[model samples]
Target chain A: MESRNFKRVYVWELPVRIFHWINALCILVLAITGFIIADPVAILSNAEASESYWFGTVRFIHFATAYVFFFNMLLRIYWAFAGNKYASWKAFLPFSKKRWNNILHVLRIDILLQNEKVHDIRNISVGHNMVASLSYIALFVLALVQVFTGFALYADNSDWFLPDLFAWVVPLLGGDFAVRKVHHIATWFFIFFTIVHVYLVFYHDWLEGRGEVSSMFGGYKFIREDRLKKTPGNTKEKSEQPSESKPEDNPKEDEIIV
Target chain B: MATKTDTRETYYESIIKQGYSRRDFMKFATYIAAYMGVETSMIGQVVKSLETTYRVPVIWEHFQECTCCSESFIRSDHPIVSDIILNKISLDYTLTLMAASGHQAEAAKHETMEKYHGDYILCVEGSVPMANDGYCCIAGRSARELLLESAKGAKAIIAWGSCASNGCVQAAYPNPTEATPIHKIIKDKPIIRVPGCPPIGEVMAGIIVHMITFDRLPELDGLGRPKAFYAKRVHDSCYRRPYYDAGLFAESFDDENAKEGYCLYKVGCRGPMTYNACGTIRWNNGVSFPIQSGHGCIGCSEEDFWDNGPFYERLTSLGGFGIESSADTIGKVAAGVLAGGIAAHAIAANVSKRKELKDRNSRGRDNEKQLDD
Candidate 1:
């Protein structure tokens, strides 16, 4: 085993991390309560109907969490402009030629499993890869859809101006039933996205030996010194690059640390 | 030809002429005002309007319908309402109810169109079939021609039932006849849609009385339904709503839950999505609505409700997919495929990584051996 130099780079900002965790929690709560609301379990009690507000409580939680989810997304959108370069909106949207090229590279190496070797360190992303960033963009759009449909359904019972503004969404989609169907199906998409996202995060963490999982929490990712130097514009914190030049004397110790 | 009288009879005079006393007319006024959701303070105003205003001329047209709206209107609980509104109070032409038929009915309709030109209310009880150059015809003229001709001089239009308000059964999927609602045909006029399969008789009466009292269309919702009647969903006002909130749904029609008056949401009730006054006004003179009689609401009044069914199944079915599959079914199948694909990808990733590692280890050993030599 050879010794290697590692540099820790700040990736996800504090607002981004907070947004990610809160958004994840909100989706989990929304999906569970949403499914239950769609097909409720019959809970029979000898107690009077007035005494049992179990379904109402479930709906209340769903509605309240939905507001949190909506506002959290708004905060994230604002941070995309205000946050650091790695957390910028430019990274998510595939407008530039470099981003499109990176997307293809990711598709070949990571998704398709075409090659295990990265021929160039410059192709490695310190922040989100093109594919992950693209998927996050898609997720943002889906979240908007869920919000619109959710609030539109809420409009029927509510007199508040905010929910009422979405009343046109009902007739536009044909009816209340259609809106409910779209909202329900979009939930399954979140489930699918979560499964693939968690799996890929673990895969990348194991494959690259980068602090992928912990980076989300502490907002720092460990990059090899050689790769960090090769990655253009990512070497802004040159003073922070030469922190640890630890020797890989034992592979077992490296495994335990990772 | 019918004589065009300059002096039109007031609703009070018409009701009085129909062998009803002033007291009966007042009772009828109060009954209609309550049903119309008019404020108690406005009851006197309603009485005053009925006394002063001349009876509004009505031209009732039937097209691709079964005449159920007419049947419902005649069977209103208040005999004076049906008797005066349908028979005496200047209902110039109705194919189902008018005694004058053939040329006599046609002449009477023409007379009202000429005399009351822009003052007559056109009540359409059926959908107009647009396919095959208007397949549904009346008196040797196509329904479209008759509708357009009658609608041209009307003060306002009233779409009486689901047949006229929505396309109803005739406009369901693969509608060969291409039946269309009145609102789609006449865009200029203020069309108030009172849309039940056969709207509650009292509701029909109440709308008419509202028009007479207010001398204009009642306040309407986005769907052009009277806000007073169609403001809340049937589920919202339903007596079984507490059961639904409590999650005590009837599993089957024959279950003990059914006997205990549980909510019928599981057995395909459309009350949650359907907006109507069925829960409050009820049918058969407020005797019992469908829910009270232990049958789930079929959502007959909503648009494309005929296509949105198998009336006995819950709303989980996705009709746009061409096949009748529930959202859960499609979602489960997709999830299964995704999970299987992920498992396969993970195995491939691990195998490729292991091979890469072995190659790297051998290459490192070879380089060390070369250095030693």
Candidate 2:
């Protein structure tokens, strides 16, 4: 494999990178603020209880933060339609008959037990394949439900404004306590999925010489030169892409930069 | 419905002879409506029901009960319950109150049953024992046979107190007599239950007023008790509810908290689960019920009041929507999970960054030598 050189290709766009980081930061703020509203810490000893005016201030902050978070989610929802093939739901969902089997195998063997062989990037598919795709969809659904239930509870006391649209969710949930329990339980799932995701992103960079870490943020990765197109950026050095005549070929790569 | 004796004429004459005016009748009507928990506007309807209809020829039955129901009923402050119920309503026979006894009392009961069969109301005041071929007998007739025979042509059957509504103290666990209420013995007639250790006097009166006014039984709960009396749990309307919500309770009967009017929940108050009008209609001229008399509720009106356990012990514990699961407990569980997640992120992020740096540095060193060549 010493002679094998992988040529680079640009796969991601700038809007996609900016949207990903902004949405992540918003979710972090929302989660922290939500917990604080649920149980306000008495930072000062003589402070008033939840019925006091200050508690209302805390809820306002929580709602305002939710507005910004939901706004970013809406933008991401639209981007899925306008973005490139890899960013679309059709691309992310494992739909092909052959690719679908590989996804299921990886989910059971790797996700259940963290199978090291399955961790290899070559074993991962071009699209989301399985685990990654399901994580994003589940997180998205939970975030929407959180907003719906939150508004239902708030509307019970307040007048018809922002909460009117979601007020019907309250009756279906039975009461405020039911909505509260669901929201509290969903936060734990979001936390668990975030932890495993960061681990896999870095693991691929070390053993595979794949720019899996940078391809997400910087939008490009190097492919094997013998098997794929030669990069125009590296045109000064010729013969990176091998002739079809030589079936098995290898070339060295100088830099494995993102 | 001739009422056989034209008792209304003789009844009015006696009430007049007793020196009561007609204005007293109107006042009795108003008082009965309020007691019935009927809306105030329905007072006129009550007056018409009692005045137009012939006094129901009632043949009162007694079996295993202590006769406390009649004692409580006759003392009803709403003079009409006692007046109309006893002297005016044509209560032709009751063993405890009849001036005549033995064969004469038995003759009076049979006379009313024969003359007004299929028309008169039959009010039973006790449970009928069903064990050992009905060993519980009266006048050489078994109580079971007496109840069935009396109820056969009755227009409606009213079980007066807990003994007749439920089995009461006699029906406690390992009940030997197998004392059963009217509903269990008779299957056809419309039955209305008024249950209590001895039901509130007003509740007894209210049940009759509803029957007389509507010409039907009052709306009943699943247990056959009039909904007006048993619809709400005693806890729902208790004056001690604020104390329960504030988590202040009397720890024991002799504790200092007991004197302060704190919730009696810790001291075996069954008020939380028991349903009755004790807090409102109360007993004997709206004076007080057991809980108001420095004793906790025995849940006397509830089914199986005797077997519910020692009256002095608090209920097992309050069970409901997270009233006990404090806000602090929920917060700690959430914080524990959050802290663990953040720590995991910090460790994983550091590992990922270092691994990425080392790989990039190794590639940079190899490229530097190749450039020199």
Candidate 3:
């Protein structure tokens, strides 16, 4: 008989979770409104020009959502500094050799579907895996590009001071037409990222048999008790470095006979 | 080399000699003041400058461009304006306007450059090609050589059109000539870019009046364009802006909506992105512009507008793709393919998941039997 044990670990903080959902909603609004603005749909309204303002409404929604998205991203950056280890900005960088090894192991199991027998217990992360953290950083940069080009395009039409600040971006990027092209293309990058992101979340939940999807909704993840005792190669250094134990010399190579 | 015209005839005396009455002169002065977007009180200042200033000793240079700028300048609604600006300004050295040709014209140009050094306004009407020394030449010297010499001794350089302001069509994609705008070549001088295919004649005259009245360059934007004229986009001041806001657009040039004066955005009007004074001041004496004539703006004033995309296409097609594919098309195709892949992967994952669960159940039953034994 085998014993199966579970220990609930608090992974995502409330602020991190809030940032995720709000950013998702903002992206959804921005994509739809952005497309409509780029190629407006014809509405058959017999009323006077003043009576129907669908295009204007679409643009206003896009601009409003853009502001919300910008501020939400700023809040997430602030949280990265103040939040716990799991949510900290440090998690995004694949700085250590062990972290790189874990990333390769994850790629093999999840993407290539190889080396299923050697499912290293070190691969189990209580929070975002290295891959997800890195992708989040990329998404943050893409969001910034959108804000800059969007506000630059709007600066001439808008009465606000913030949009005016980005006016210099227009000429810097070789004029309005080129900037519009870049802004439009970046919108699709977000859409593609969203599709891949959702699929991977569901796949990871199924593969790990842990509260991956639900952990985003509720901040708890079910971590194995045995895996927590023997810290991963990267984290082992942080826990007391004993003089006699040379775990670093030959990192735990034993495989469970399931 | 002293071409300072021993006769010191100011612009007022010259215009008066050209048979324009004093009343006509005052009307022209007030009209110019309005065109410059200056205060009505400054009309006296403009009139005084014209009466005293010694024509500013202009040397209009032509390079790799059509003479459309000169044509536009001469076609101002006010005949006195064209006459005074072209002839009365002591336009000592212009290839197009000057009666002297050959050695006489060459001598006249050199004389002005020498005599009025640091006092002349060098109005460059075209781009300078830097490839192979230079493709544009005047009187045995390359355009680059002539420009450097003229620019060295000039007070200010006014880039007269899109050709001189940006590289225009000559500097478009795959430019073999390596045509460069004057400002890019000459960095030391204040180069005011009057950027249109050929800027409005009144606007050209207005800039000259501004310099003469204020004794300084007009306030310039980041691109070195006069802010008063280029600050607002055509779409911002356009009469058809209401139509754009209301989601109304002309399907084509000959469509019912176009005839009704709806916005031309759909048929590829660059008005939204283009910043020029076409909508407010208009062209041809405030009579009509491209939009009013039921044609979309080609964005001629914008930098590298020719390479941006097809004149009629609304969106610029993504580069590195075959000519027809735009960003939207490529993105949609990619998304569609990714969606299909995700669906297939999910289905495969489900089938494998079920097989693995069944295998695990059988293994668990074997384990139970072993435990019982």
The interface root-mean-square deviations, each candidate in sequence, come to 3.4, 10.8, 3.4
lDDT of 1 by residue, B112-169 (tens): 9988889999999999998864498889999999999999999999999999999899
Evaluated on the second chain alone, the candidates' TM-scores are: 0.92, 0.80, 0.91
| B1-373 per-residue lDDT for model 3 (tens digits) | 1234556788899999999999999999999889888889989999998887767788999998999999999998788879889887788889998899999998988898887888889999999999966488888899999899899999999999999998999998788999999999999998999988888898898898788777789999888999878888888888888888999877777767766777788788888888888998888878999888888888888898888777776887766898879898999899999999998877766665565446546656766777954
Best by TM-score: 1
Candidate 3 structure, TM-score to reference: 0.90
Q: Mark the 10 consecutive residues where model 2 chain B has the least summed lDDT.
A: B314-323
Candidate 3 chain B: minimum summed lDDT over ten consecutive residues — where? B1-10
Q: What is the per-residue lDDT of model 1 for residues A1-258, given as tens digits with 9 covering 90 to 100?
A: 463456777767889999999999999999999988888876557888888888888999999999899999989889988887677777677776666888898898889888735466556677788899889988988998999999988998787898888888877886676777789889999998999999999988867667899999998887777643244555665333222123342222111111
Candidate 3 off by > 4 Å: A1-3, A229-258, B1-7, B344-373
Q: What's the TM-score, to 2 decimals, of chain B in model 2?
A: 0.80
Give the TM-score comparing model 2 with the true structure, all chains together.
0.53
State model 3's lDDT. 0.82
lDDT of 2 by residue, B1-373 (tens): 4454564654344455556777887787788788788888898888776656666678889989999999998898866568767876678888888788889888888888888888888999899888864557788888888888889879999998989988888887678989888898898999988888798888887787687678788998556778788766676677766555444556666766666666676566777556688888777798877766767887887676675555665422112424344334554566677667656755654454555446556776777667855
User: What stretches of model 1 exceed 4 Å from their correct place?
Assistant: A1-3, A116-118, A227-258, B1-6, B320-324, B355-373
Error of 1 at B362 (Å): 11
Error of 1 at B120 (Å): 1.3
Per-prediction DockQ, in order?
Answer: 0.35, 0.05, 0.44
Order candidates by TM-score, high to low. 1, 3, 2
How big an interface RMSD has model 3? 3.4
Which parts of model 2 are misplaced by more than 4 Å?
A1-258, B1-14, B317-373
